[model samples]
Target: MSADTSSRSSRQDAFDPFLQPELFEGVRSRRIIAFIIDAFVITLLTLGASILVFILGVFTLGLGFLLYAILPVSVALIYAAFTLGGPSASTIGMRAMGLEMRLWYGAKPYPLLAAVHLLLFWFSISLLTPFVLLVSLFSDRKRLLHDLILGTVVINSAYHRAYTREHSAAA
Candidate 1:
């Protein structure tokens, strides 16, 4: 590479999560708590959906009962995707845990990116379970496989909020 290209590459490398541990402080523990909270939220939503489906099914002469096959999963996915992909880039759980997801470069994710991130996370967790959590133990960013694959990071919300305030002040 040319000198300029080499310099830019080196700068990027310096910003790598593996090289900068501060960015990921407390993320591992917070992530676990966030998952628990999110699961509870999804469960509540699914239960509510199930009740609604049952009522509708009864009124519809049992036709609505067919929805039971799909309601829970659909409700969970929709809730997860919408909340995680929203402007806040956090689910209710993550918010409660004071965490948020962002691009590796520290930009807030758009809704689609957020949804895909959650989808990838679920896929990885389903496939690897314990192994996925183990991967975070070795990562400097405390990132699981899906986070690494998607070029994203979960960081302390206080850091993000401070950064936002500083930038807004500068602007």
Candidate 2:
């Protein structure tokens, strides 16, 4: 390969967990914390949505009961779509934990990808909780089953920020 092609390939290889484990340093622990924070935030949002649904049901002669039943799921979907689909590719919890999700190629996922990622995550958790968790333990990237399926990885935002700063300075 030419020198230019070799340089480009090396840059791409830097993101491969097997080639450079540092790219995913501390990701497993941070991901767990981020999950906890996201769950708490989702719960609070669902609760508020449930209350609104209840009030509306009172006015609709109890028809809001159906809405109340799905309020939690709906709230979670909206929150994940809006936050994870943003430029940061992270939810509020992920941001708080200084983590972000990116495609395997290091690109931010679009809104649709984020929503699908969330759906796949919930599905995997519901059907294969133990297996899903175990999958990450065996992977060099520390990626869960859903992440693998979606071709995405969760990375430390702080590390990315530092790398960006250093690279920009060099440039």
Candidate 3:
């Protein structure tokens, strides 16, 4: 009768868009806002990292200048890995937009998964550009290509996670 056992019994009870439409309400728009905010944050972080790399280049007499080539990507991966994999499962930008990402099977995302998600995003955008985002328009859950590949969904934080928390608390 434990919550964990009950939840496991319903592994098939995935958050159904038909059953709980609230979860998907405004999700696509919210996701757009979240993406914009996260991009801005990543840009700011990249700028800071660029400055550090410049300083390192000065200290190392230009040897560290090589790192400048990879600094933005490294900073992005680290930021996404730690923040998306953190307790809230959201980046600072996501938090600002009141959104969170969750695995399709009702588990939290881990750092490795988060980092892979980010990499896939970059790859998909590079290859598909405008089409990468269009997939969400056709998906019931508003999942993009990387999301479908990773079995993840982004949800509004102001809604039903509290119901999940209460369900989980009984364990």
Candidate 4:
């Protein structure tokens, strides 16, 4: 279902896991795998950034080397902001895994929200460790704590277009 942009409605009326089980199929597992892929991508990005910093340090006599301290987190947030917040509403890794993220009512998340989603995820992991993922185990929609807090849900991109206007009209 699309966002209820036609009018205001409670989030309770949003996508329901019970009603759209297909959307969440294998999501819990896919999410973990996706994270691995994204982490690898981020590592590569950080390495590239490190190279640039190294060159800059040479020019500045090591002043730029200080960037190394924040390079990883900076790359991660910028990566998530552009990819997850882009038109696809999924990161490169998430797209590879056939996953996408949507707001509770089915609208795509904007750049800022996507970035915050990542920050919240990091914050949760920092406070509770990776064990925070256990929250999804009990969630009907298989949403992690960051998702719940952001009112977002992850779903299989394979079915993303299945409920589009054309399909609904055909039905």
lDDT, candidate 1, at 15? 34
Candidate 2 residue spans exceeding 4 A from truth: 1-14, 18-20
| Candidate 1: worst-modelled 10 consecutive residues by lDDT | 11-20
lDDT (Cα atoms) of all candidates against the true structure: 0.81, 0.86, 0.88, 0.90
- lDDT, model 1, position 99: 88
What is the Å distance of residue 58 in model 2 from its true position? 1.8
Per-residue C-alpha lDDT of model 3 across residues 40-67, encoded as one tens digit per residue: 9989999998898899999999999999
Deviation of model 4 at 75, angstroms: 0.3
After superposition, candidate 3 runs with Cα above 4 Å error: 1-9, 165-171
Best by TM-score: 4
Q: Per-residue lDDT of 57-126 in model 1, one digit per residue for the tens?
A: 9999999999999887687778866887777888998999888887766667777777677778879989
Model 4 Cα lDDT, one tens digit per residue, 1-171: 457744556556556778778889999898889999999999999999999999998999989999999999999999999999999999988999999999998889999999999999989999987668888989999999989889999999888676665568988
Encode model 2's per-residue lDDT on 55-171: one tens digit a residue: 999999998788966787788888888899898899998999889998877788888898899899999999998999999889888999999898888888888778868988999
Of 1 and 2, the candidate ranking higher by lDDT:
2
Candidate 2: deviation at residue 131, Å?
Answer: 1.1
Q: Candidate 4, after superposition: displacement of residue 45 in Å?
A: 0.6
- Per-residue lDDT for 127 in model 4? 96
Tell me the RMSD of model 3 versus the true structure: 3.2
> Per-prediction TM-score, please?
0.82, 0.87, 0.89, 0.90
Error of 2 at 38 (Å): 0.9
Best by lDDT: 4
